[model samples]
Target: MDAKLAQIREDREELEHLLSLAQRARVKDMLSINLRKLDTEYIVTKEKLDQAQVAVTLGQASVTNTPVGRQLDANPVIKAYDTTIKTYSWDQSDKFVKVFLTGLGDLSQVSPDQIVQQFTQHSVSIRINQVGDRNLLFNIHHTGQPIDPKQSYVKVKSDMISIYLAKIERGRQWPHLRASDEVTQKPIAPPKIDETADPSAGLMSMMKQMYEEGDDEMKQTIAKAWSEGQSKNSPF
Candidate 1:
């Protein structure tokens, strides 16, 4: 049962990472649907594992007097927050913006008092106490828009923490999650093409530019496609 739960959880995490890296709208939709299915399966499997453990514990009550059983009871497994959450996702509605911070480990055993939140008119910070070896910290120095800090709040869940920011202006929409995104960086000009250059040269130049400017996942996808094309065209 433990092995089954672990496998399901691993699958769910992988699907989530792929969904984050997915580029196309169609692909994102497909991954999102499949990820949701895996999430449900993980929850069901976890419940079953818990039930099995409880049954075993009940059956072993008589053996608790033994040294081995006593030691086992004294030393429980501690799952720590070893994985740092580096990125977050946000969405907005008519009067609030919701920021989701995932990858938090096993908050079911953690108390609400252990989680601390600080909010200002335009920023928010979160700290989780006693995450085994280290404390977890998450902060947004500046929000895209002003929020009513008095009304904003955080919620801790078994898997993640969510921050709800109340929009000061009732129905106004936010342009971005962070204030930094609102300042547009200067665009890089496209590569210059000569009229006499080979038609394929122009395509190659465009691909090079994309590879230079794209994110890590985009660069990887382009490299994979280029390798497959070269392999298909090569002849011994």
Candidate 2:
């Protein structure tokens, strides 16, 4: 997964550079060609990356649920570390809450410090200990007084592999926290594109639309393709 992500990053960087050069040279034709190719590649790559991430997260969850996994999580050494770190979270009402987050994709990529930085607004501290390859034990600490767990909530950002403390109804499971509404409602499949209508023209139109409306990453991909085109001396 890491290798694939690295390669994708390299590809994206090259495309971005090409797009920059195309714009600078004012080569409208080359720019248009690169935009279409980049848009197509970006859509495919993004889908692959998303699927890979989901696989990693699901694999982690599976491993973490095993008997040995449970034992590792419950280890006294881990408990001691959690106590030593003094990490915590508080709700909007300023009530203390305990948060356990797991099933994260690319756990090795995210550091405990990064987690703390992400929750600076809540003034929450965090301690993350890797129980094994697939599980991370989080100890969250809040400066405020303890409150009812019922009034507290867990906000899971599936895309970011982040878990934030929230104020909502209780009864939601921990470690296997549910995804946010936005994530759940997001489309699982890409939009359909016509393939039979003058393939090149149809693709160009679709790519143009996607480029204009796509997110930052998609735009970066279009840019990268232009860069790649310039480097290879290819129109596409």
Candidate 3:
């Protein structure tokens, strides 16, 4: 999939270059013929890239549908935990709620023991497992209760868990954070246009340029190419 995506990107770059050349050429007819071909290739490659992206996303989702993940999802306490922490917007992949703790500052300075202590104070039971230097994987269970052998644990990132703890410290109730508080929509800016640049010479001008630049033989070839490209039955 990665290789295919790379190839598509490379193809797009090449197509863009060809399109630029076509737009600049003085012979309109010849340039138009090749421009259509380039456009078709660009569109097809773009569609393939989009399909590949969707397939990759679906593949990731399928991994989370395994037997263990299903069992964890079905657990009553885990469901409640999910409902309670939905405001944090942690990544719920696999049976564990994987949180990327790298967003928080200084993992080295943050003591895992201190974090576990804080959660205990808040009546949340969790087992902290540090993965490498940055990520802290949490296995959440009912406070002070031993994890059942049959029950799968819920996971959370240390950073989000810290935020949850902060809310508790402020005397906020369980599920205290509202959905609106967790999400804010940013307005998207319109694409910038360079006003000083030549207003695109347009397709007709490009075709004229192609015709003007080409020799007699080139002009004949371009005319044929254009006719073949424009044919309704042609499979270009």
Candidate 4:
């Protein structure tokens, strides 16, 4: 899974790069041609990379921490299983969420590059590879690990891998969503999903809700975010 995620990371980046080329086409014909190339490659490459990595790491240890050193000191398959067991994994609980956020199932019909573009207008767009999406889905469903409310479209978005990267970073930097806010002088409460509506619309609503209901002092605190959509910014 991790490997596939890495390749998807690569593929997503590459397709996005190509999409930029396509988007830059001045002529309508060129636009269509470039767009087609980008969309098609994104679909095919993303799937291929995702599947390829999954094939290797599925149901196994991706990285071998202590393969023959401690766990299998005298095992016959020591050499055979010496490889690391650290790879991306798809848990039964998060399988659906994984495909959903990665823009694999329903959103797959749309061009990933375009979808990513809708959020920020940065020179280079970003994508959420499967691994990070996997983690985000886990947090969403199991741990109530609130995704950043600032990521307004996260509800129906395919920008997970990157999203999790932010979540991880926030956790590392702040220890909790309760970020420091000099204005309110308090940490914000984590966000929780209330309903399952149109994923994108639901997300937008969720963000507005947070902003409206949050303590006035904390509103500014939570406003700081990683941005998605077309503005030359990385996925938040």
Per-model TM-score, in order, reads: 0.44, 0.23, 0.22, 0.22
Q: After superposition, how far is residue 96 of candidate 1 from its true place, in Å?
A: 1.0
Lowest lDDT sum, 10 consecutive residues, model 2, at: 77-86
| Location of the lowest summed lDDT over 10 successive residues in candidate 4 | 78-87
Note the Cα lDDT for every prediction shown. 0.64, 0.40, 0.36, 0.32
Writing each residue's lDDT as its tens digit, candidate 3 over 38-144 gives 34444455557656666665555557968765664464221001111222343332232223333433344445453332243212333333323222323221111
Q: What would the per-residue lDDT of candidate 4 be over residues 1-236, giving only the tens digit for each residue? A: 34433543443343344333321112112222323333443455455755665555532443555564444334322111111112232221221112123333343333333333122222212332333222111121111122333332433333322222223124233222211111233333334444334333443554466557755432443343212233445453
Predicted structure 3: clash tally: 9
lDDT of 2 by residue, 169-206 (tens): 33443321211111323343333456444434554565
Better candidate by lDDT, 3 or 4: 3
Question: Which pairs of residues have clashing backbones in candidate 1?
Answer: none
Question: Model 1, residue 60: what's the lDDT?
Answer: 83
Pick out the ten consecutive residues of candidate 3 with the lowest summed lDDT. 76-85
Q: List the residue pairs that clash in candidate 3.
A: 26-209, 26-210, 27-209, 27-210, 27-211, 28-207, 28-208, 28-210, 28-211
Which is superior by TM-score, 1 or 2? Answer: 1
